[model samples]
Target chain A: MGQVVLKGINKFYDSVHAVKDVNLQIRDKEFVVFVGPSGCGKTTTLRMIAGLEAISSGDISIDGSVVNGLAPMDRDIAMVFQNYALYPHMSVYDNMAFGLKMRKFTRPEIDRRVRDAADILGIGELLKRKPRQLSGGQRQRVALGRAIVRHPRVFLFDEPLSNLDAKLRVQMRVELKKLHLRLGTTAIYVTHDQVEAMTLGDRVVVMKDGVVQQVGEPLELYNRPANKFVAGFIGSPTMNFATVTVTEANGSLIAENAGLRIRLPDGTARRLRGHIGHKVTLGVRPEDLTVAGAADPDHPCFDAVIEVVEQLGSEILLDMKVGQDVMVASVEPTVRVNVRDKLRLAMRPSSLHVFDVKTEEAI
Target chain B: MIEGAIWRKWAFFYLPMALFLLFLLFPFYWMVITSVRPDGELYRPWNSVNYNPFWTWNPTWDHVRYLFEETLFAAWLWNTMFIALVSTAISLVCGVFAGYALSRLNFPFAGSLGTGIFITYLVPQTLLFIPLAEIIRNYRLGDTPWSLILTYPTFLIPFCTWLMMGYFKAVPKELEECARIDGASRWQAMLYIVIPVAIPGILSAGIFAFTLSWNEFIYALVFLSSPEQKTVPVGVTSELIRGDVFFWGPLMAGALLGSIPVAIAYSFFVEHYVAGLTGSVKG
Candidate 1:
């Protein structure tokens, strides 16, 4: 029943506070991913959970028991490091069997489990080869095979896929999800890639500067971000942000800057009623924008000049100049857009996001 | 290898290489020739007709025979072999453990401790032998092989430790971390995973420690007083040359024979030695 809970987790490296007040409850068989920019304490938190790092003042319980003082071996967990960390001198079979051997399993049982994990990872034929003889992808499989042979209560992944090439990384991501489903083991994965976190995690934890910004399902994080940082971090092409002043007119609120005068929708206006006549930040996602039609008068329309056009086959990305701010619009591939062309774009009312200027938190 | 004219290749690479090889091998060539040369040919004046100092057509086994018969050369060989092997084994065990701990563990003052150990290696043996001789006399180990065996590690352990520290540092820390996470205790992880991965480094350190003790002169010469207890360097030098008259033949013969074991050891583990020196830890 691998349920892991961390309470009041704090880490200090001498005087540098690497991780601050992290509390998380990870349920059985759940694949949770902690993601953020470099030095955001995601890896530190994972290491703490693995019992690899000492907790300054907190409790980490695994399988309903406090493991704060236990060694990593007693934690009954396996980890896949970024570099694979395969034993250079040992063959693949030996590498996979090491953990089982350490745990004092019988020789035949160790062999059977090693081969089973090898077969699962499609590395049975590579059992006799050393790590130096295997390709990057094959070595990665061996590392995974080594971890799976133990049947540990929890699996810790520290940017395991970051070392693979782009094509291989995508391929392994699907395999990892499938492996989690097959084993039904609790896993905590850490990475800096937002897409990986969004795709693989049952619940994604977004962090910034040693603090967790938000924790939710992938779509929830994308749809309703807690702060401007989450909104900008969780999506590709980055949500465009403009520091605009909110003004009330005609019993509504309008957020406007040097180039944008967007009439806030009722939902956004009601939330911003107290925010009116104050400095606020306006946020809009690229995919929520489309070419405005004459009949769509209810939609908020704004004028922008296309500075560059990127044809991505599946979609056309227009880098547009909106007043004094630059924004990216992921438009339909069929749209015939050119550089320096003035176009009117509309924002879906429900998709508009407003954040506080000072706190950078969503309003 | 110079990618240009033929003359450039010859001048830049081949000529210099040939000169370097000649310079390096000339001493060994002289030793071998002198050891085998007849007593008359060696004693002949250089200005005499057909001096032929480089090559001796009349080669005899008299020098080698005298070396074995007239001196305690066999006993010296046995003493040197036993002392070098035991001391090297002792130093290797201490070095590997000290190096692994200093490089990997998170103990307080680990960095300073490592530096301090390395600084011990820098102390000259010449000065160290004076105090060591006093200790040897007090322990009543003055004329025994134990004196040299016990004292050799003073320098050898530090040398081996310093060499091993650099090698252990090159090994990635993730391998041990993964092993620990895989169920091995810290000590088990070191023994099974880290030590095995560092075999090349160990071999290199062992070979160096072995050679260092084998060729060590100051401590061996000072500590061993008995003719039978003396090592090769001391035995060959003291017993062979009777006061002012030097036994060049047996001395050369002894030098030539003394180097064979170290040469064989080097050739045996040449690949690992090179790899260890390069200190590359493949991920």
Candidate 2:
């Protein structure tokens, strides 16, 4: 039973507080991912949980026992590093068998485990080759094999697939998910890629500036971000944000700017009831903004001129100008649009997001 | 690999290479020729007819024979080899540990401490031998193999440590971190992952340390006074020359023979040495 918990864990590097007061509880057989921009403390938090980095305060417990002062070896975990970290001098078999050898496994047991892992990774025939002789994907597989051979209680991955090319990254991501399911071991993955975190994680933790912003399932974080940072960080083509003032008129709410006005839906207006006459940050995802038609006169429509048209085969993304700001809108491929042409775009009322400008928190 | 024309190849690659080789190897050629030239030809004055100083005729082993039989050249060679190897071993052991610590561990003052160790390496050996001589005499290790062996690391360790620190820094820290999470202790991770990956760096450092102690002159001259204890550099210069009379033949023979070990060492690990110098730990 692999269960890892971090209680108010903090890491300080001299005067710089790198990871500040992180608390998490990873359940048995759960796949959790920590994702953030560069220097956002995701990797630092992963290293702290792996016991590679010391916690300046608080405790980390693995399997209900506090491992704060324990060595990484005593923690019973295996990690796949971003560079794979395959032992260059050792053969693939030796690299896979190293942990077993360290634990004093018998020759037969070590052989069995190594061969099983190699077969599982489809690298059985490449066991005799050194790490330098293997391709990048093969090295990645061998790295994975090395971690699996130990059968440790917890597996830590620090941007393992970020080294692979695009197509290979997707293939390996699927394989990693399958491997986790087959092994049924608790795994903690860290990456800067939102797509990787969304696809691979059972639960995703989004961090920014050394603080945990939000943690939830992929769709939850995408559909309901906790703050402006989470809204922008967890989606592709990213959510477009604009500062609009909430003004009460005609017994309803109208979010207004210089060249844009949208009537806030009743549900959204209720949340902004006390914040009238104050400015709020309006967030709209690219896919949530659709082309308005004459029949949609009741919808909140705004005028925008298409600046750049990007046809991505499956969908067409329009970079359009609204007042002084540019926002991207993902539309159906069948919709005909061109640069410098004016269009009326309507935002999905139920999907609209409003954040307090001061706190940048969802209103 | 120079492209375009044949003239460009010769101008850019071959001709310059040939000249550089000649410039580099001329000293060894002179050493080899002078050691073998007969005494009649050796002092034959450059003004003599049929001079041809570059080529020698009627070669003899008399200089080599005298170098071995008359002077304590064999004992000096043995002494030089023993002192160099022992001191290099001691320095490498300490250096590898010190270098790994300075580069990898996040101890207090690690940055300044590394700079401190490197600063010590920059101090000229000429100045260090005086204070060292006093310590050698107080400990009564003077004129013995231990005198040079123990004192050589004083300079060698810092040199080795500095070289190794730069090398260790190039090795990815992820390798050790991965190994530690694989259930290996910190020491095991270093042994299994870091040191093995750093073999080329270690060889280059060892080669550098070996050559430094092998060719060290001032310390050997000041510390060792006996013909039996004197290394090749000190013994050959002091014993082969007497006042105004310079034994050119034996002196050249000693020079030629003394450099063979270092040459062999360089050629033996040339690939790893180059890799070490260039920082081969890419992964």
Cα lDDT, model 1, residue A190: 99
Q: Which 10-residue span in candidate 2 chain A carries the lowest summed lDDT?
A: A293-302
Q: Candidate 1 at residue A247, lDDT?
A: 96
Candidate 2 lDDT tens digits, A106-196: 9999999999998889999999999999999999999999999989889999999998999999999999999998999999999999999
- Candidate 1 colliding pairs: A259-A323
| TM-score of decoy 1 | 0.99
Fraction of the reference Cα-Cα interface contacts (below 8 Å) that each candidate reproduces: 0.92, 0.73
**Stretches of candidate 1 exceeding 4 Å from the true structure:** none
Q: Which one is best on TM-score?
A: 1
**CAPRI quality of model 1:** high
DockQ winner among the candidates?
1
